[model samples]
Target: MLELDEKFFSRFGAEYSPNEIIFCEYEPGYEFYFIQKGRVRIVKIINDMEKTIDVLGPGDVFGEMAILEEQPRSATAIAMDSVRVLKFHRDNFDALLQGNPQLAYKLLLIFSKRIYDAKRRLMILLLEEPNVKVMDVLIMLAEQNQQFDFESEITLNTTVRQVASWAGMAESEAQKELTHLARLDKIELYEDRIVVKNIRDFQRIVASRRKNLYSS
Candidate 1:
């Protein structure tokens, strides 16, 4: 987890919860550092269709763009579950970043990582898994949440719509794949998590999808 200094937390506004819309497309809001105990969804709507672009969890931070540039949001941020966040206004964030060089560097690094993840998403969209992009999203989630010393059970707290948006697939299709995976004994659903039964199987599916894209 990215540790925030006392100064940052002290100056932050109140915490928020699940299902709350933090920001809307083209709207302005304070920069937020969400320590997601559950899940959060980043959405972008285009041409009248809603697309979920990212599913975030613990240690994830967003809303930096608004504070950095004093510009409107390019997308919408919604809490997918009961969540905790540290919010800072643009002025406070600017002061913090300017005074603490290391903190600024860390924030920049986080930004770079998000850019990298976005590039990976573009690759998945352009080069592979035309129909199974949701699987790719699951694979990414598995990588992030996989248990150590056990090849089984990656715990994820996300919804079908969120996964579908990340994968650029329809929600029904994403649901179908989740069911199929459960039937295949690759994963199992719990009350609050999707337990990955076989990480290798999911990885193999993602690899095969990538290969198909490369060869096509």
Candidate 2:
């Protein structure tokens, strides 16, 4: 890793709320990477629809692709949770390329990983059935935690607009689904977080919509 000045990160550019977009107008800027905590979803507006390009969690990085290419940002990045990210200006990249070959190589690796994950997400999005896709999202979250406390609730800080972008659905459809699920006692809204109430019930929904990938 290249030497980074911690003091330089005092402000961290800008802060964001869950589902709050960081770059809406898509102007020229520096590349940024979240070194602290939380999740971020990179999105793009296409055909008047907000489409999620990728989901980035802690230790994950983004925004360098545009800076490297000397192009405008291809998409918007929204905070999936309250987040702090370190930004690297174009000058910083220029310096690294000129003075630190190792750092330059590291940036390449990060870009590769981002591309790989984006491909996987695109394939998953192609699957038919909204129910199945939604179930997959829940299962993915469950696996992220790797816990099975039926009594405990797992809350996600996301909105219908954000979930719709992630699931390739209309915002209204996503809202309807969420409302239906909540009415059926499958989930509950606890403040800003969406809580999965009955874990077993949610699992059954996932199992019912399970595809071949769920098999051993």
Candidate 3:
């Protein structure tokens, strides 16, 4: 929920239609963007296939790492739907940081959290059991979809292929694990979406799996 102000729109506002490519992997980038509306997906090429790493919505920032490090883009960003974004060039971004200390501090916090999440996902990938890995991914997705209501089910707007990619397993294997969970009344999977029964129960399942992992 970035406040869309008059000055902001006049300076850096731009709109992208659904399925548009915002940036491609390995391309040189000089600007970062903040989503003012809609959603975007961050994807990386793995084994010659595109794997979605994340989905970002309004108020989220992307391409900052390239701007900060002066490096080529690490992943491709594409619009998930009609999107409005405010772009900031590297020099302009530096100027804003110097003038707005609070903005700089907020960006620092966001970057740190992203780094920590990446590390945790890496650790999850190291787990030996496919079921454990899948459960960890589902729990992560559930947490991300959680808002203020802890009692409500979280709906994951994602595909089985993407979940399989995140879990480091084949699509069939992921499907089997998901079916098993459904049979146990743990989750409900639709064509391209999943409904997590409850976040607390999801966490309990993950904790139970971790215990089993260590005990065995």
Candidate 4:
């Protein structure tokens, strides 16, 4: 999906099954990858629970930060589906980029967007309300995945416990807000997923709470 040159397909392409571990956190960073198909989940252990911080689709890049900093991986990458990716090793990465100007520009654009996204997530963490944090985390994921819509139902492949971990709150607190949202028909909770009745429904509540954060 990245419009990568066919020259690398045969030489560097790799395939993975669903639930396969691409790399683990703190491991040596030998290479980075760009998704060619399906999805990859970027996870980290937060409050002793594994949480999906980012879900990457085709054309996305992961494991680059480690390569850049010459350090261990910051998070774990897992295949969420039968996925295909093009792997780039650190040794040859410079040569490849020097020869492929177009590829370098494309990757620069993506890295810029990732930085902006990180800033927005930091703002979400600044909010004091546990409930708003939960809703904002959902909003953040939906927005990142480009799946948010006011009139359409979207099922987030996440559970209350995962949400709590991402939001840095207790699981019980996240579940309570989820149940309240379900009572209002804003969301439908399942064992492993939460179907957002309308993405904008949660958006409105999150915005309103932020507005009243300094109010009496």
C-alpha lDDT score of every prediction, in listed order: 0.70, 0.65, 0.82, 0.83
What would the TM-score be for candidate 4 when compared with the true structure? 0.69
Candidate 1 lDDT, 1-216, residue by residue in tens: 646666666666345577788778888666656563667788888668867777788867777776658678888988888876677667677676777667577677888988888887776676454445766676676656436433655667777766766777776877787888778777775545677766677667778777876787
* TM value for model 1: 0.62
For candidate 4, list the clashing residue pairs, or say none: none
Give the per-residue lDDT digits (tens) of candidate 2, residues 50-70: 677678776566777656576
* Candidate 4: tens digits of C-alpha lDDT, residues 15-82: 99999999999998989898999999999986687878789998888887755778888899999999
lDDT of 3 by residue, 1-216 (tens): 556577868888988899999999999998898898999999999888788888999888899886668789999999999999988888897787776676677688889988977876875687777877877887776666546255777778777887887787888999998888888887898998888777677667668777787898
**Native-vs-model 2 lDDT?**
0.65
Better candidate number, 1 or 2, judged by lDDT: 1
TM-score of each: 0.62, 0.54, 0.73, 0.69
When sorted by TM-score, best at the front, the candidate numbers are: 3, 4, 1, 2
In the predicted model 3, the residue pairs found to clash are none
Separately for all candidates shown, the number of backbone clashes (residues 3 or more apart, or on different chains) is 0, 0, 0, 0
Model 3 lDDT-worst window of ten: 141-150
Please give the lDDT score at residue 123 for candidate 3: 59
Stretches of candidate 4 exceeding 4 Å from the true structure? 3-7, 15-20, 46-49, 80-83, 138-162, 184-216
Q: What order do candidates take by lDDT, descending?
A: 4, 3, 1, 2
Please report how far candidate 4 places residue 7 from its true position, in Å: 4.5
Candidate 3 lDDT at 52 equals 85
Q: Tell me how far the alpha carbon of residue 28 in candidate 2 is from the true structure, in angstroms, after superposition.
A: 10
To one decimal, what is the Cα RMSD in angstroms of model 3 from the true structure? 3.8
